[model samples]
Every structure is written in C-alpha cells, then in structure tokens.
Target: MAKRATVADVAALAKVSSATVSNVIGNRSGKVSTRTRQRVLEAISALNYTYNENAATLRSNKSNIIGLVIHDLSNPYYTELIAKINRQLAKKGYATILACSDENLESQQSYLHLMQRHNALAVLLCPTWDTSGEHLAAWHDLSPTITFLRPVGSHESDFIGIDNYQAAYDLTRQLIADGHRQLAFIGGSQSSRLRRQRLQGWKDAHEDAGISWNDAHILYCSSSMSAGSAAVMQLFQQTSDVTALVCYQDIVAFGAMNALHYMGKTVGGEIAVTGFDGLSDAEGWLPSLTTAEVQIAVLAEHIVDRLLARLEKPQEPPSVTLLHAHIHWRASSHGDVDSSHAR
Candidate 1:
C-alpha cells in the first residue's frame, strides 16, 4: 500500500519551503508568488495530497463557516428564507451549517453547542419561545450571534425581523374599512412575541376607530393549520357576527378557510379572511387570500449581511432592523375598499 502524500513531499517536489507549501494549501493571509503557488498546487495534485481542514483551522484559528439555527424548517417561510440565506452566503464565500430546533429550546441549545464544537465564526438564530437572553448570553460569551424572526429578549446581540405590528395593524384596518365591524383574530401561541405584536396591532386599529375591542374574539392558537381550523370553529361558535378574520400567518388562514368551506359558508361573499406572510399558496386558495407580504428574501439577505458585518466588526453596537410589509389584495377581501392607503 502506498503512504499518503505529506506536505513535506509536496514541498520537496515543488522546490519550495514547507511553509510555502502550507501557505499554498491553506490559502493563508500572505503573498506567495503566483509561480510558486502554481508549482505547489501542481505538486500536491500530482502526489494526490489531501489538505486537512482541521489542521488548517488549528493553525489559523478560523473556521470560515456560519451556523444557521431555525425554529421550524418545515414552515414555508423558513424554508424560503433558508434558501435565500444560502444563496447570499455562498456569494460571500462563506458556508452555512443549518439546524432545526422544532421550536424546542433544548434542541436549539444542543444545536448551539454543536456549532460551538465546530468552531463556527458566527450564528444566525430564529429562537424558540422558551429561549431567553441569558441562555443566548451564555453562548454569546463563546462567539458572536445574531437573532432573526424572533428575538430572545437580549440586548447582547443583533436582531432582524419584519414589522409585525404595522403589518397586522394595516390588514385589520383594511378589513374594518371594508365594512367589517365584528373582526376576529386567529392562530397564535400565547407565548410568541410575533403573535403578541399582531394581536396588539389588532387592538390598536380598533382603538383608533373608537370601537371597543372584544377579548373573546381573539383566539390563541398553536400556530398550526389544524389549530387554525379549530379556532375558526371556536370563533363561529362564540360569535356569529364576525364578518372578517385576520390570521397570524398564511397557513393558518388556509386552515380557517378550509373550515369555512366545510361549514358551507361562501368565503368571499359571506365572510372575509386576511393572512400574513404572503405565502406561495395564498394565491391558489379557493378565494385568493389578502395578505401582508413579508419580504422573506430581503430579510434573509439583510440578516446575513448583518451577521457578516458583526463578524468583521465584533465591537460594533448591536443593531435591530425592522423591515416594512406590503399588503397584497386579492379576491378574499372586498375589492371596493381603498387599499392604496394601507401602510
């Protein structure tokens, strides 16, 4: 059996110092003559030499890799965001190691440890409901991290998310303007900040209109399609006067729409539904949904950019970026309402 080629052998064949061979193989931060680099590379190829990344990382103390932690990869929003993140990071010559938390804090913490073990330069996280700043702070002591989608309630890191409050506010106001006096909200876990924001927006819109808010109309759901379907049943059971419903997300709206169909109700003609996160399937629903379009791709790119910027300048103050939302009016809501005024 032939022995594996060593750096020394490549150096001897290229007629360069071992350090030059190391520089060529590792692409270290130093100027190596192009001719010498070519010779070393050629020698390495001819000798069938394989570079040890671990050994290279030990020498440079840099992994050139980023960790991406998401709560639910199965969600269409996260899936689309991850794809955009991958494309943006690839353009910067950085690779991402992705982990799904399934909205479990313990699983998310374990993935963070795994990233630490791999010497990740930085992490981009979409934390679970149970995640706290202290938990993130403990990890921040090990390396830099940026939170996305959901904040962990820590000032120790950066954050990027859509303006949930404003988006929900505008959507609800649109429904109100369309002659919907009795409005209902569905699909949100009581513990979610995003849910809280959207719910607050609903309240705010009602307050601005000088209409009394109804606590009974707000449904706390488990943030699933099934939960949304059940919530729709619950809403109708409790309040028969609700002419419109605002969902926390498109998937939830889809479920509620399905329930309405099951109950023999005409969606656009009798009742209206609005959803957030302008999901791909929104346009295909029985009555095309009116939704607040979050720029998922733009958010992904911004998060990556912010993470990289922090990597380059760790001492910089943490940044919190909130992106605006656009409303996509469709067949679900009445078309006569002036949607142009929606923020």
Candidate 2:
C-alpha cells in the first residue's frame, strides 16, 4: 500500500508551515491568506488526506459543528435564512445540524439535548412561544446558544433579531397614509413577544393618526396561510368595512388575498393587503405584496458573527443585536402612495 499522506506532507507540498496547514484543516482563526488556503486545499485534495474528526474532537474538546434549532422549517422565511447561514458557515469549514421544533416546547428541548450529545460548539435557536427562561438557561449550560427571530425572557443568552416594533409601525403608518381608516391586524398568537411588539406598532400608528383601533379588529391567530384565510373570512362576515388587512407575515398575506379573491373583492382596488417578512415569492403574486423587507442574508451573517464571538469569549456580557427592516410598497397595498414613499 502507498504511504498515507500526513499534515507534514501537505505543508511541504503547499509550501507553508505545519501550523498553517493545521489552521486550514481545523478552520481555526489565523493570518493564513486566501492564496495559502487555496494551496493547502489543493494539496489536501491531491494527497487525498483525511483528518480524523472524532480524535480531533477528543483532543480539542470542540467539534466543527453548529446546531441550528428553529421553529417551522416549513415556513419560507426560515428556509431562506438557513440557506444564507449554511453558505456562511461552510466558508469557515463548519457544518450545520438542523432541527425543527414545529413550535413545540418539548420537541425543541429534545433537539437541544440531542445537540449537546453531539457536542456542538454552539447553537443558533429560534425558540418556541412556551420556551421559558429557565429552559434556555439549562440549554446554555450545554453549549453557547444565540436566540434569533423569536426571543425568550430577559435572562436568556444573547439574542439577534430585527427591530419588529419599528418595522411594523412604519408599514402600518404607510397604509394609513394611503387613506386606509378601517384596518384589521391578522395572524399571530397573543403569547408571543414578537407578536406583541408588532401589534404595538400597529396600535401606535393608529393612535398617531388619531384613529381609534377597535379591539374587535385585532384578530389573534396562528401565523399561517390557513389562519390568515380563516381570519379574513370571519372579518368580512362580520362587516365589509375593513378596507385594509395587515398580516403578520407574507404567507398570511397570501392567504388573505386568496380569501379576498374568493369573496369577489379586488385586492389593491376595493381592499388593500399588506404583510411582513419580504419573502421571495412576494413579488410574483398577482398584485405584488407590500411588506417589510428583512435582509435575510445580512441577518444570517450577523447571527453567525455573534455565535462565533460567543464561542471565543464565553465570559463576555450577554448582549442583544437588533437589526433594522424597511418597508417595500408594491401593488398589493394599492400602489397609490407618492413615489417617495414606495420604499
């Protein structure tokens, strides 16, 4: 048999130090340049060298693995975010292990335990509504964890998410400017802090415009297409005066539009519809959706940055990073606003 290739052989062939070769193989932070990394990779491929990951884990007490625990993988919002996150992590030679909670607390806790067993270096979590501070603290003991999208109580570890209240407030304010007086907020459970922040934004917009927001118009439901459709149906059945529907997400907005079409109401003409989370398919709808554009790629980058930072400095103070989101006005929300307010 041919002699097995070693790290020394790779370093000699790549014309770099053994330490540089090790850094490239382990994805450790160093001053290795792109040119050197490429040469090391080429040498690795040419030599068909394989590092024993299990032995490495034992020696270093860490794995080249990151756990991603999220709610509702079925939602496009999360799927898009994961795509960006996967790309960014791969560049650093790390692999991701994904777990879906379906918004169930037991399932989420179980998945966290599984990640701990696998010895993941850290976790990026989008926690469920019922996930308590105590549960999160326990998970933090297993690994460095960062919460995203959905936030837990104050005592939870570091969090990275958009400014939900400001984004929602801006969208609502624009709809009001378009002469929508009788509005309805749809799709979100009352128990969620995210939902509450968004709801507060809508309420604030109404108050600023000197319009009374009716409690009857605030409909609390699951953030889904079916729920949005059902809620819109109920709203119309009660009264046809709701001229605009502000949905918690683009999927819910799609459902609302479908219901409106079935009811023979013309979206963007007879009644306006707006949504949050600027999804990829938003622009493809009959009358493109008006939504708050959360930069998924940017958000993913920030999330990875924070998670890695936590891993390096585990003793650092826990902090929150809130990114901004902007509203994109399209045909769905009537498209009649001044050109300056389009985005």
Candidate 3:
C-alpha cells in the first residue's frame, strides 16, 4: 500500500510551513500571496492530501469563516461590492459564506440560523426590511454583525452605507431642473428604511421646487428589472403625466428604459429617466443612464475595516459610517444635460 500524504509532506513539497499548508487547504482563502497559494494548491494535488475541516475547527477554536447576508444577490452593484469584500477578507485570512434573503424575513432568519450553527467569526449584513431592534438583539447572540444599507434599532451598532436621502434628493432636483415636473419614484422595497429615506428625499425635492407630487406616483416594487418594468406599466396606466422616473437603482432604470422603448416613447427627448447605483451597465444603455454612484470599493474597505475593528473590540460602542455618492448626468436624464453634466 502507498503511504498516505500529509500536511507536512505538502508543506515541504511547496517550500512553505505546515501552518501555511493547513491554512490553504482548510480555509482556501487565507492570507497568502497568490503565487504562494497556487504553489501550495499544486503541492496538495500532487500529494493527494486532505484535511478534516471539523478537526481543524476543533483545534483552532475559530472557524475563520465570515458570513455575508444581503437582500438581492442579482444587483451588479451589490455583486461588485461582495466581490471586493470577498477579496479583502481572503487577504485577511478568512473565507466567506453568502446567504441571500431575497428581502424575505423568514429567509433571513433561516440563513442567520445556519451561520450560527457554523459558529461564524462575524457577519456583514444588508438587513431585511422588517428587521427590528429586538431581532438585532437576537442576532447579536449568534455573531458579531456589521450592517449596511438598512440599519435597525436605536441601539448603537456598526453600520456602513451611502447617504440614500442625499443621493435621491440631488438626482431628483437635477431632473426637476430639466423640466420634469411629474416624476415617478419607482422601485423600492415594501417598507425598508433606505426606501423611506430615498422616498422622503424625492418628496422633499418636489416641495423645495414648489411642485406638488401625487401620492399615486410613488410606486413600490422589488429591486429587479422585471419588477421595475411592471411598476412603470402600472404607473403609466394610473397617470400619463409622469415625464421623469426616479428609479431606485440602475437595474430598475434599465427596465424602465426598455419598457418606454416598447411603448414607442422616445426616452431623453420626451421623457427623462434617472436612477441610483451607477452600475457599469447603465453607461452602455442605448441612451445611457444618469445615476448616483456609490463607490463599491470604498464601501468594501470601510465595511471590512469596521468588521475587523468589531472583532477586536466586541464591547466597544457601535458606530455608523455614511459614504458619499457622486451624481453622473447622462442622456437618460435629459438629452441636453448629457453634454452639460455627463461624468
């Protein structure tokens, strides 16, 4: 019989320490240079060595696993942010586990419970719309969590997100300036804090401009292209005067544009459209999209930094960090504003 391979054998073959080999094999996302990691992987393959993850967890008393919980996994902006965070955590010697809530409270509860069973080192959560202080307290018992986008409870807690209010306000104000009086605030979660903040901004902008907005124009839908398309159709059925659409995000904006095109309406000429989350796809839209850019890289750095800090000082008072948004004007907002305000 052939002798069984071991971590020591792989480490020696790779010209690295046994611990490094264990880190590579156990977590697959540990603090190692890309070259060194590849070398270790090759060595493991050559040796046919495998380590028991349960035994490793028992030995280390830490899982080296980070849980990422979010509402929608399909959004490009969120996906980009997750990729950056996954890379950053890998460099810090941690593996990531993702759980999508699909904005459902029950699903969020199930995923959080699963993370608890794994004894996750920490969690980065984009909270469900219905999350409350009581719910947060229950979750705190499971893992240290740093929330983003939607925050719950009055209790001090770690949170990092963009200024939803200001972003919406700025974009709506610009659309109003472009002679769009009847604007529809489209695509929002049922009752999310971020949604409320954004809706308030849109309303406040109308008031500031001395324009009255109809309550029926405020339409709520999931943050999805199909949902956005349906919402636009429904809104137009309700009223035809809505010349501008203040979409919740870029994906929704794309759907709105597609719907308008199907209706034989010339976008940017007769009707204007604007959205948040300056996703790359927005720029490639036929007429292009005007949006508020929330820097994902910056948000990831802040999120990871705060996560590490939380792990270090579990008892420290919680804090909130709101990142800035840069507005990019394009033909989607107005045909003339493209040259004047495009970024």
Candidate 4:
C-alpha cells in the first residue's frame, strides 16, 4: 500500500519552511508572499495533501467543529433542521458533531462532556425533557452554546425555537372555525412545557369562541407515530365524539391517521386532524396534513449566526429569538385559513 502524503512532503516540494505551509493552509498567509502561497498550493495539489484538522486545532487552540445535539434523530423535523445547519456551517468551513440524547438527561450530559473534551467551536443543543437550568448554566461554563426547539429552565444561553403557543392557538382556532367543537390533543406528556404551551393554545381558542374545553378530551402520550395510533384507538374505545385531533407532531399525526384508516373513519370528513411541524412526509401522506410549517432553513441560519456571534463576542448578553410557524391548510383538517404569528 502507498503511504499517504503529509504537510512535510508539500513543504519539501514547495521548497518552503513548514511554518509557511501551515500559514497558507490555515488562511493566515497575509504576511507570506502571494508567489510563495501559490507555490505551496501547487505543491499541495501535486502531492494530494490534506491538513490534519485535529492537529491544526491543537496547535492554534481553535476548531472548525460545532456540536449539534438533539433529543431524537428519528424525527424528520429535527433531521431536516440538522441538514440545513450542516449546510450553513460547511460554508464557513466548519463541521458538525451530531449526538442523539433520546430524551435521556444522562446521555445529553455525557455528550456535553464529550464536546468540551474535543474543544468544539460551539454547541447547538435541542435539550432533553429532564435537562434543567443548572445543567445548561454548568455546561455553558465549559463551552459556548445555543439552544433550540426545547426551552431550558432558565435563560442562560441563546435560544431559538417556534412559537408553540401561537401556532397551536391558530391551528385550534381553524379547527373551531371548521365546526369542530369536540377536539382532542394527542401526543406529549403533561410534564412537558411544550405540551402545556400547546394545550393552553387549545384552551385559548375555546375561550375565545365561548366553548368550554374538556379535560377528558386531552390525551397524554409519547411523541411517536405508534403511540399516536394507539392513543387514537384507545380514545375511541371509551368515547367516540372527538371531531378533531390536534397532534403534538407530524409523526404523531401520521400515526393517528393510520389508526383512523384502520377504524374505517374518514379523515377530513368525519374527523379533522392537524399536526405541528410541516415535515416533508406530511405533504405526501394519503390526505395531505394540515400542519404548522416551521421555517427550518431560516431557523438553522439564525442558530449558526447566533453561535458565530457569541464566539466572536462571548461577553455579550444571551438572547432569545422565537420564530413564527405558518399554518398550511390541507385536506387533513379541512382548514381554509392561511396565516401565521410570531411572539
């Protein structure tokens, strides 16, 4: 097998010192002559040499690596957001180190430690359910961070996420306008702030319309397609007057739709369904889902922008940016209003 090329080989071919070569490769060649930089570049191409990023980071005490930690990678909404973030970071010559916490606090803490040990540039965290304000404050001491999606208990870091209350309120009002008085909420535990925010939105819509909300109609379940489907079946076994279901996520809505099909119920006809997060799968489902479309690419850009700004000026006060989600009306919910809100 042939041995791989190294920086030394490039330097030998270019007839320049190793330091000059490092300067050229690391984009610190402002002092070096352009002629010498061209020669080093030509030699690098000729020798097919690639810089060892790890070694470079150790020498300069800097990194082009960012950590991206999320609760669940299986959710398309998060994976799509990750892809957008990766694209934006790559443009700045940074790489992403992804970690899935699976909603486990211990696993998230371990990943934070790993990021610190690697001297990562920054972290874009979508924290788990059990993550507390103290954990975020302690982790920030180790490395700069930007939180998204799920809110940390305290405001210690830059935060970017959808306006859950506003989006859910808009969705619930659309359902109410469509003559859906008997409404149910599916997915997410009662302990979740996100769930509570959405539930409050549902109540807000009911109150605005002079309709009394029923606690019995609210269902608590895991944020999974299977769990959603099972929840629907279970709901029907006890009662059968639910005219609409406002799901916690697109995946959960998909599950409920599956259960409805199995139960010989007509979606968008007898029972309306709505979902959060306009994942790509939602559009292609049998009956296209009526969902709140989060601006993922825009959100990713803001996350990267905030992290880079913090990296440049760490002493600046932490801030929060809550982006709006637009409701996409479709056959699933038989909704006709097209609008959005930011708060």
Candidate 5:
C-alpha cells in the first residue's frame, strides 16, 4: 500500500519550505510567490495530494467549520435562517454544522461542547429560554460565540439581532392607531429575553396610548401553531375582550388565524392578528399576515461577516448590533384605519 501524500512530501518534492507549501494551498494573501505557487501546484498534481482539513485544524487549532446552535428548528423561522446562513458561509469557503437544541438548555450546552471539541471557528446561537449569563461565560471560554434573536443574559459576547423592542412598539402603535384598544400577546415563555423585549414594547405602547393593560393579556406558550390555537381558546375563556393579538412568532399567528376561523369569527374584521418574523409564507396566505419582517438576507450577511471578521481579527472588541424589522401591515391586521400598510 502506498503512503498518503502530506504537506511535507509536497514541500520536499517542490524544494520549498513547508510553510510556503501551506501558504500556496491555503491561498494565503501575498504570502506565496507566483513562481513558488506554480512549483507547489506541479508537485501537488504529481503526488495527487489532498489537503487534510482535520489534520490542519489539529495543528493550527483553528477550523473552517462554523457552528449554528438554535433552540428550535421546528419553527420555519429557524429553518430559513439556517439556509441563509449556510449559503453565506459556503460562499466564504466555510462549512456549517447545525444543531437543534429543541429549546432545551441542556441540549444547547451539549451542542456547544460538541462544536468546541471540533474546534469550530465560531458558534452562532439563538439562546435557549433558560440560558443564563454564566452559560454565556462558559461558552465564550470554549469558543468565539455570537448570540442572536434572543440575546443571552450575560454580557459575555457580541450579538446581532433584529430590534425586537422597537419593531414590536411600531406594530403595537400601528394597531392602536387602527383602534385596537384591547391587545393580547401570545406565544413564547416568560423566560425568553427576546419575548420580554417584545412584550415590553407592546405594553409600553398601551401605556403611551393611555390604555390599561394587564398580565392576563400576556399568554406564555410554546412557539408553535398548536400552542397559538390553544392560546386563543385560553384567552377567550378568560375574557373575549382581546380585540387583537401580537404573536411571538408567525407560526403562532398562523395557528391563531386558523383557530379564529374555527370559532366562526372573522379574523381581520373581528380580531386583528399580527405576527413576528415576516416569513415568506406570511405574505401569500389568504389574508396576508401583518408582521415584522426579519429580513433573512440582511441578518445572514451580518452573522457571516461577523464570524469571518472575528476569525481574522480575534483581538477586536465584541459588539452588539440591532436592526429594525420592516413592518408589513397586511389584511390580517386590518382594523378601522384605511389599510395603507402594504400586504
């Protein structure tokens, strides 16, 4: 059996230093002379050499693999986000290792550990509801991490996410302008920071409008269609005064819309419904959903650029970025006002 080709063999065959061979193979900027690169290429072609990424990672303690750990993959929001980030990473010559934590804190930690073992370049996380500052500290200790959507409690690292509070405020104010006096917030648990940010925005809107709000109006449930439908029944059971709903997710809004139909109630006319994460499906439904569009392409660009920049400039100070989501005021949230908000 023939021994496998290594960088050492390539360097020896090409009469160049091993570092020169590595620079040529890695396409290191302005490092390898063209003459030397040509020689290394010829030697590699002659030997049929294949660079071993795993071995290179072991030696340099750096990897071209990026980690994506999200709390829920069941939500289309996360699925689409994964797709966008994966595409962006692939374009930059990095591979993505995705893990769904199912919103479990323990599972999330386990995946972070797995990524650390693989020496992942960095981990982009949508933190679990119960994720704490200590968790962020420990994970940061292990690898470069950027938390998104729901920022971690601890000021452990950088974050890039939509401006949940502002977007919710804008949406809620719009609902108020449309004459929705009684509004309900549905989906997501109390433990989620992102949910709290959104809820605060909703509550502040009511306060600013001189309208009374209460805790009963905030429904805590899993971010799913079933939970959404159940939340509607649960809200009506408590009091049917809720004139509108502000869902934690678009999926939940979809469920609420379905539930409203089953209850023989008109969705937009009787009880306006609004959703977060302006998913593509939200735009094409029978009554197009009014939602805060997260703009996946823009978010993915931020995530990937942050990751690549971190790899190149590890010493730079970490920062948090928040971009406002575009509000699509469609027929679903059609209230008393003239529907000027585009579908």
Candidate 6:
C-alpha cells in the first residue's frame, strides 16, 4: 500500500511551516506572500494531498449537515418533498442525512439517536403516526428539531404543515353539496394528529350541515394505494350506500379508483372520490381526481428555511406556520360550481 501524503509532507517540500500550508489551503493568509502560497499549492499538487474533513469538522464542531426524518420513502409525496428540500438546502451549502421510520415509533427514535451521534446540526422530521410530546422532547434535547408534514404533539418547535382539517372539511363539504350524503373516509390512522384534524373537519362539516355523523363510515388504513383500495372494498361490503369517498392522501385515492375500476364501476358517475395531497398523478388519473392541492414544494422550502434559522439562532422562540390547501375540482366530483364561488 502507498503512503498517503499529509500537510507536513507538503510543508517539508515547500520549505514552509505547517501553519503556512494550513493558511494557504484555507485561503486565510493575509501577510503570506502570493509566491509562498503558490509554492505551497505546487507542493500540494505534487503530493496529491487531500484535506481531512472529519478532523476539520471535529475542530469546528459542525458537520454542515442536516437530518431529514420521514415516515416512508416509498410514497411519492415524501420523495418529491425530499427532492425539493435537497435542492434548497444544497443551495445554502448544506447536505441532508435521510432516515425512514416506516411509521414505527421505535424505528424513528433509533434514527434520531443515530442522527445525534452524527452531530447533526438540526433535524426536519415527518413524525411517525404516534408522535408524542415526549418523543419530540427527547429529540429536541439532542438537537434543533422541526416538524414538517406531520406535527408532533404540541411541543414548541417549528411546525410547517398544510391545514389538513380545513382541507378535509372543505373536500367533504364539496361532496355534501354534490348530493353525496352517505360519505366514507379511507386511509390514515386516527391516532395521528394530522389524521385527527382531517377527521374532525369531516365531522364538523357534517355537523354544520345538520347531518348525522356515522362512525361506521370512517375506515382506518395505512397511507397507501393498496390500503385505499381495500378500504373502498370494505366500505362497499359493509354498506353499499356510500356515494363519495374522502381519502387521507392521494395515493389512497388512487387505490380507491383502482378498486372502483376493478369492480366495473365508473369513478365519477357511480361514486365521487376526493383525495388530499395533490400529487402529480392526480391530475392525470382517468377521472382526474378532485383533491386538496398541498403546496409541497413551498412547504418544504419553508420547513428548511425555518430549520436553518433555528440552527443559526437556537434560543429564538419556536415558530408555528400553517399553510393553506387549495381544493382543486375535476371530473372526480359532481359539483360544477367553482370552489371560490362556494366560499
């Protein structure tokens, strides 16, 4: 094996002190002659020397890296959001360390510990389904942490998420106006704060309209296309009177659409389906899904911005930002009036 060159070797060849070589490499010299710097560069090139990044980070107490914790990478929503976050963070001269929890609380906590070991300056978390204040507090004590898509309990940390409750409420209300009285909700664990908000909105809308809230219509499923499809099937098997379905996510809506197609039923004509998280595929679906368009890119940008700001100023008060979701109407629903007019 060949010996690796060090700064001392370059200094010995350049006839300069190691400090001079360090100054030249870091471009921090003010009094060193340009000729001296040039000679150090030439010696470095001859030695094929590389700076020790780990050693440098150890001295600086920073890794110049941020941690990103998401529930699942298989979902297109999180993947797209990560892409946006990566692009924006890279522009700020930072890198991301990604971790997937698979909606498992234990797995998420383990990843947080790993991130802390890596000296992550901050963490942007898409919390697990069972994110409690205790879990968030433990992570926050390790490093500056911010909640992205899903909020963790009510801990005072930066939170950036769409108004899931209002979005779901509006979608359900749209269905109600479309003559969909017997509605069903598909996907999402009721324990999750985000899911709870959406469910509350559904209940509020029905209650405001003087309609009875039916517990049997609410179906809990994982946020997946398969889950959505299964929920639709289960709903039909239990009660065939469901005229509209409100999915917690667009992927679930996609699954329900597939289930409807497999059952030889028309999506828009036979039953209306609305989804949250306006995924790109929603626009191209056969019936063009009606959904709440969550500004994912904007949300990612804001979350990164907040996280970086917190990293720069840790003592600052925590921020809570709620972005609104726009309801996009298409052929999936029966209403012809624009949402703006309904509002």
lDDT of 1 by residue, 205-283 (tens): 9899767768888988875688889999988987777778899999899989889989987787678889999888888
lDDT per residue (tens digit) for residues 77-171 in model 3: 88998999999999998999999998888898789888887878888999777887677677786678899877875455698988999999998
lDDT of 2 by residue, 1-343 (tens): 9988988999999999999999998677666888899999999999999897877898888898999999898889999999999899999878999999998999999999999888899999999989878888877877888999888876459999889999888888878888778889998887889889999999999999888898889887776788889999998998877788889989999999999999998888778899989998998998899988878988999999998899889989888998889788888887343343332
**lDDT (Cα, 0-100) at 247 in candidate 6:** 88
Ranking by TM-score: 4, 1, 5, 6, 2, 3
Worst 10 residues of 5 by lDDT: 334-343
| 178-205: candidate 5 lDDT, tens digit per residue | 8877889999887778888999999999
Candidate 2 lDDT (Cα, whole model)? 0.88
Query: What's the C-alpha lDDT at position 183 in model 1?
Result: 83
- Model 1 poorest ten-residue lDDT run: 334-343
What's model 6's overall lDDT? 0.86
Error of 4 at 181 (Å): 1.2
Q: What TM value does model 6 have?
A: 0.87
In candidate 4, stretches whose alpha carbon ends up further than 4 angstroms from where it belongs are: 1-9, 29-33, 335-343
| Model 4 C-alpha lDDT per residue in residues 61-141, reported as the tens digit of each score | 888889999999888888899999999999988888999998899999999989888889789999987888898777798
Q: How far is candidate 3 from the true structure (C-alpha RMSD, Å)?
A: 5.6
C-alpha RMSD by candidate, in order: 3.3, 4.8, 5.6, 4.2, 3.5, 3.7
Instruction: State candidate 2's TM-score.
Output: 0.86
Question: How big is the positional error of residue 290 in model 1, measured in Å on the Cα after superposition?
Answer: 1.5
